[model samples]
Target: MTIDHFFQAAKIEGFQSPYDTIHLKIFYPARMPSQVEINREILPVDLEKAPFPVVIFFNGFNCDAQQYQWLAVKLAEHGLVVILFNWIAEVMPGIISLTPGIDVEKRKPTIYRTVPTASALPALLAKVEQLQSEGILAGMLDLQRIILGGHSAGGRVAIENADPDFFPQIAASFGYGLHTMATLSLGYEADTILPLPDSLPLLLMGGTCDGIIANSCDRYGISPGNATTPVIRTFQEAITGGRNDSYLLLLEGANHFSINQPDSTLKTPLLDFPATQPQESFRLLMGEIINLFIDTHVRHQPEASQSLEQLLNTPNPLIKSFERK
Candidate 1:
């Protein structure tokens, strides 16, 4: 609830106190049905600067825009413009029910219904472009340097939008297991998903202990029998065909819940996921890694690359890093 709780839950450390200048602005989609309008929140770094790199993040199933506030703030703190998007379908069942009877079991819930990755891209791109034209994003945002990332179901959205062919290739490369089960449950067929356009940079992050997704993939019978590498590899392969850069990182000892903000009382199960390091340590590690990843790739800061390399080589049994071919 509190900003401190958000940062702490995200495992952000080494700060004497919380930064107070993080600003938020919300944008409502222009033409979608009220039930389907997208909500975007912009968080700019507390410091003054011209044209920073921008990161537009999408949230996972049943999660609201705040789910990514911690990560977005972290990126903004490092001098990037961060935008968190809330998919209207994920939160509007009442409106969906009014349209026609919806099958909760057979059809994906409104929130889980497959959205064309392309459908949302233009709206998002236009928002940033508008900011540039109006001078709000002004010198601080480098229009050319943008990164897209997400978690759990949101991660699927990110990849699907970047390259629709991602899931099918994942299905084919990994075999019919957990990955397949997830694909089937989501109602995605190998033939229907599209490919990513040549313009966007992508980064895929997954936790070692991601129970829902990895477990689902495992139960369905995907390769590696667990959630770790197979999904990551699929994403790496999908983005390689585009001109944009791509990278996949596996946070060692981290579970799906750990990546989000912990509750104020810190009593949430998010604090208890099994990991080699204590929960806080792993969270901080993940935050730092994310910071470095955005800095190196989005901001074009060469020094950030060294930090990433050092973290990768560190003898942490829980972490793994890979670059797409």
Candidate 2:
């Protein structure tokens, strides 16, 4: 469908038009040391409310906090507060020398060379706590309802942070690739992959077309088909086995870049696929789907789940959705 058509459909579902009142602010807490210092951006909704559901986004390698600005704005418009972070340095100091042609800003070139997952988690958790304590996320911020997500390497970090046992087996099978791999191989200790704390809900999104980090199913070992399946299975296993509340969505023809704003400047060595789905349509559909999920899971809005069920079963070639068992 055309981008205009998609926007019209989104509006029909209560999706708000993109609003820029969404401000991104950085917070520095004096309690942490310089290296452990946190860089977080708070995107508040236009509505004047005390509390809002919170979504903390961990961006992929080479990507900065601004990469998901469009998404943050869209979600905020739906009454959700979105936060994105630059947990790792924007540019890896020396990875450019080893991996040429990789986009430093978008793809997170340095993340491929070192493992910063363990080091990054505490800062993220701290930021969440700080927001709660200071009332920056006061009434609007629903501590009981939180969604943690990321892309590519950031996805790996999120999973590892959520469950340490997550990658140990995979790491045993395939040595570290660049950054994350190198670090995992060094045998740094990490927190156990316990069920997501009751206070935090989990959402995992990744490109079905990512091939940079290859493994078992595909020859390169990094094919999306291989990477996504294991991650999804692991997440499902954790949630289902624990009977925890969680949700998962896999965009069929989407790649790593689909989740980020289409206008980002970073480019990677991977093939840039054609826009099988119009960018605006994809964004609108994604925004609406996410809203539905949060409304039902976070806010206890039953009607939102019914509407989302219709959207998921709509049989549109451009979009698809699934619920974890």
Candidate 3:
């Protein structure tokens, strides 16, 4: 956990699949090179921090990977590898970019905005192999240490696909503004509330002022606002394996898009309904907590266990609520 490494991103164009050519924008710790890639000032990957853990992420609906660069770079500076992909809404590109499992109906996932593609782990793992062969991150990726994480609906996909039997390499799963509460469209009596992930260690987070979940009532038919704290509730009631490794957190004055940058009104979305706290302030606290989870659960650091408990239990200006099962 030091931010001594300078991070940089590189783009790699094609990993063929039935859905689309899966493109990636990877963020990793790098060193300035004297002879950089032609037009762009691409630097060489930092071999000093070789075999770093990987974080393959999914973004919220109507959002692109670039919006999450703030979080990606934060993780990268701490010597982790972060990967994001090129995705589109197909019809409107930026207006309604859709992601898989984001629009599940009757417990069956749908293709919203006409992309006709799924953001499953298979496609992403294929790309990681391609990145290795292409020499961008050659011999530097640690397959044994991986985490699948996302935001909002993108978070839903991460939770759904975290299968230990299938993707054994993924050590943990996390989602900010995400939960497994069954929805009306998913054939559950509206807001049936608690259906937790049993496969992976999960980190579910939300904000008190998260207006997005309220707005989501129409599409998914889950409980609105604080009628019940579904995020914390899901973590509380979860059974064996997932329960032992899970954590629930609520940010005091944050919003759905707090993990995103406050760089521009254009870059962030109006659908978020305005975040109460400064995004960076929120993410500074977010990054520290996220790293703790990754370091403890994913990397299996024995020392981090004590620090994680103390940080969550102690008083802090940023944290509003905390629970662990």
Q: Which candidate comes out best when scored by TM-score?
A: 3
lDDT of 2 at 9: 9
Model 3 segments beyond 4 Å from truth?
Answer: 1-19, 34-41, 90-106, 109-120, 218-223, 238-243, 262-274
TM-score of each: 0.61, 0.59, 0.80
Local distance difference test values of all predictions, in order: 0.46, 0.45, 0.67
Across 103-123, the per-residue lDDT of candidate 2 in tens digits comes to: 222213334223323343444
Scored by lDDT, the top model is 3
> Candidate 1, residues 1-325: lDDT per residue as tens digits?
1111111111112212331111223221112223333342322223344455566565544455575566765665556566665433322433311011112333243433353432344456566666677633444456766555555555554444443232211100100001112344455543222233323445556666655554444333454236565555456433454433455567666666666654453333443345455666655666677677666655667898788778767777666655533
Pitting candidate 1 against candidate 2, the one with the higher lDDT is 1
Better of 1 and 2 by TM-score: 1
Taking every candidate in turn, the Cα RMSD to the unseen true structure, in Å, is 12.5, 13.6, 5.3
Best to worst by TM-score, what's the order? Answer: 3, 1, 2
lDDT of 3: 0.67
